[model samples]
Target: MLTLTATPVLDVEPAIHGEGPTWDAARRELVWVDIDAGQVRRATVSPAGVVAEVGIHPGGGTVGFVVPSSDGGWLLGADGGFTHLSADGAATVLLALEGEGPAAGTRMNDGAVDPAGRVLGGTMALDETPGAGSLYRVDLDGSVHVVLRDLTISNGIEWTADGRTVYLADSGAAEIRAHDYDIATGEFGGSRVFLDLSSDDGPPDGLTMDDEDHVWVALWGAGQVRRYSPAGELVAVVRVGAANTSSCAFAGPGLDHLVISTSTQGLDEAARAAQPDAGRLFVVRPGVTGRPAGVYRGPVDALHRAE
Candidate 1:
């Protein structure tokens, strides 16, 4: 397998818990979330991995992920449900996943927009409670449906190039599963183990697929992002500076730059000192390019002003 190392982006500030890196092709920007800080970040990066500009928007509370909207607003998994951040800095709840508020101690976690423009988001308990999470799908018509359940930490959602296969990271289960996807109907069928990382490096966190259809998964606490072939073979490994590497995506004008997000959450002072680069962003070129992230096509105007 090939090996590479990532370098920190000096121009970017560190995040409390950074996750969900995505390349917005229409805006030609890199977007990610700082979950613990409830912030959505956007940046303009160059081919050589230099961050030129950044914009931060509030996500109500504890955002799981952020995706560009068909409208000028932003759609994200936050606090109790999916929220919309308007272009003018207004925030709205949009849709509540649970009841009026998040169930007792749970919050929305990582999520992504599927190829069919449907939003697939998940929820998890605050204390890492096992089997306390469920994945939810938001259709274009403003309807919500439960997709998968019995998950501990529901994270990382990505689809193959053809949009026929989905890879989901059940982080608390230490496994990533592949499911047959129906792009036309947005239904999932027969699931199988994609990568059993229970005996390997670390739990899979976020995922992205390259142009060649290989899946790249960020291994939380492993300080690495691994590239796996279509047949589930490890092809390359990108070493990161922080153990809490949360997520990654390919950005830049050509989509060839691999941008990674890290977290300092859960680390004590000593542990934070050991990984001084924790909570910072890193980048590396893996000699591969990724496709643009799926944009959310749901009804943006369905959002009501947050009370």
Candidate 2:
């Protein structure tokens, strides 16, 4: 059992949609994105302040998620394609999602790094078109693999500790699905329903797994983050008070604090006023630590590694 507590805002700077909070353990900082505003922000955990910020959209698209790269840069899943954001603030196009711009107005959204460090990013249609999104994985060998297709608002992705199971949230479907993962062969199968939510509970948004392998999901319109066991049994729920909780990540010295991102996107004036903290970052600790993401590997690690 976990001790659920009230979540408090960690950062005061609200965003149109604050999301994808990734912990850079090497720097002891929290990195996240203001999606609609097209900015990536970072803050030192101990110091509890915004350290450095960069806008990646000027290079041509909005960033959905960012993971630390081996070369001290970041691998960003952007609207146009994937961009490698250099430490000097340069956004280099790594690959394009489409030959031209997204035809269906789709762009990368929530994502997670596989145990091999390859990035698994999901896309969502800007126009909210059903079945317009898909799941793609960028390999170390410089290859892009489309893992799944015909999805709507492809979001939250995670794998079990052993790297043999994958849990993905298809927000449009309002459910999370699990797949059998082959860590050695870089393949996956056996996707089945893990959890489904009703309109009242809110749609599943971002996801993360704790040290115990319990899946923690942020409910976009529910104002809460819930945890479930590997068997998909609800374990705990933490109230965040924000209607649109986008994503969450474990942070702080012990990685025991669960920090969540919120959003004001799509909210009318009345809705925004009702939830003033709608687009800020919040943190709460339920006496659990988090798994650190693996730094992305390069060609040196090969697409196929030893089992």
Candidate 3:
């Protein structure tokens, strides 16, 4: 179901399982990960329709997520939990997640920086076992906590511009959920379903929010990205050429241009042949601006050791 009519293909990164696409405004670069391929990429992007790979992640174990560091380097989520990746590829293991550290089959998945500059990392079982995933957060004061547990296929985790609401996607449930959040305290209230995808439309994967309070979500097997209003009403839909549109982030000037990451993980040869753009990057201007991706303002000393 690859259809590109108005939006243009931005980069042909051709990642095997492109999962996280984030815009590092401080560095003015687009950073994303190829999870299955165990790689990371930094791209220089321009509104003039130019995108180039400027750097690479130190390749080794499975790398799932990456975001810019206010201090420098990358806040990385990979095997055995979170770490900091320096410019020279040296990694400093920060937090050893609960299940990941014990070789218990769980791996770090998607994550987002909270308004207070802490990271909320999610976990998923390598076997996709039900109720094996959880969402954990690292606070500014060097506290690591499991805010939510018993999740399956936990994917995107983002917050509203005002930081009053948090949105989480559990692909196994085929829905996006929202929670009341305390920006200063990093607390979460009970959540309710924000949007539920029809079983046939595919599961909701990763998502991002725009300044106008719209949440844009990628559909893993549906070959489309959908935008929803704050009230949970569908606003728009953009068809991507790939069935595995894993995640997306707003990039470029004003954070209005959407940079998408796709995956070729489960595609067989025939499926791959039908969708040639399955693993390339796609960009579209959706007429909305997103908040800047958050960076860690937490005590740097806390990131030096595992909790």
Candidate 4:
């Protein structure tokens, strides 16, 4: 397998816990979340791997993931549930995830916009309690549905180009699961183990797919991102100087550069000191390109009524 090293993007600020990295094709910007800081950051990335901050939106509480909507607003998985952050910076809670099914102790985690324009997000307990997480899907019409239950820590989420298959990482379980998906109905069929890392490098945090259909997964504590073939063969490894590598996305104008987000969330003082670039964003050219990220087409006007 091929191995490569990633370099930090010196222009960006380090996030306390950077988790989700997404490419917004419509605006030609890179969007990601600093979960612990409750911030959604937007930036412009050059093909040569330089990042310039554009805007920062504060979500009141922990912001897990953010996706641009076709309605000019942005939808995000925040502390309560799916929220709408209007273009003018107004916050509207579309659905309250806690108290109905998940307990108040739980908060939304990583999520992604599906090909059908719906948003699928998962939740986990703040304290990382086992079996206290679940995945949910929000349709374009503002309806919510539970996708999966009994998950420990729901992290990375991605889908095949055809939207017939989905891969989700249950980090606490140290495994990623692949499920048969239906874009027409936004439902999931049988799911099976896609990648088991219980005894491997590290727990899977976030992941993305390239044009070749290979999945690249970030290893939380292993300081690396790994690429695997569609048939589950290890093909390449991208090493980062930071041990808490969180997530990655194919960004840049040509989508040729892989933008990675790291963290210092669980590191001790000494460990944090050893890795000076722990929370900085990193980039590397992998000779591969990814398609434009999925955007949420859900309506937000009705969300205000629900709030």
Global lDDT of each candidate: 0.87, 0.78, 0.80, 0.88
With candidate 1 superimposed using the best TM-score fit, by how many Å does residue 161's alpha carbon deviate from the native?
A: 1.2
| Residues 1-307 of candidate 4: C-alpha lDDT, one tens digit per residue | 8999999977788999997899988888998999999898889998787899988888748889988889776888988687888876677777676453234788899999999999999998888889988988888787787888999999999998878999999999999999999989899999999999999989999999999889999999999999999888999999999999999999989999999999999899999989989988999999899877798987875532123
In model 3, which regions exceed 4 Å deviation?
Answer: 1-11, 198-200, 299-307
Higher-ranked by TM-score: 1 or 2? 1
The number of the candidate with the highest lDDT is 4
List, residue by residue over 56-95, the lDDT tens digit for candidate 3.
7764477878877777777777875777777666777776
Clashes (backbone N, CA, C under 3 Å), per candidate, total: 0, 0, 1, 0
Q: Which stretches of candidate 1 lie over 4 Å from their true place?
A: 99-103, 303-307
Per-residue lDDT of candidate 1, residues 1-307 (tens digit): 9999999987788999999988888888888889988999888988677876468988967999988888866798988688888877577887775542355688898888899898898888888889988888888777788888889999998998788999999999999999999998788899999899998878999988999989899999999999999899999999999998889999999888899999998899999989989988899988988988888997875632222
Report model 1's TM-score to 2 decimal places: 0.96
TM-score of each: 0.96, 0.90, 0.93, 0.96
What global local distance difference test value does model 4 have?
Answer: 0.88
> At residue 152, what lDDT does model 2 achieve?
91
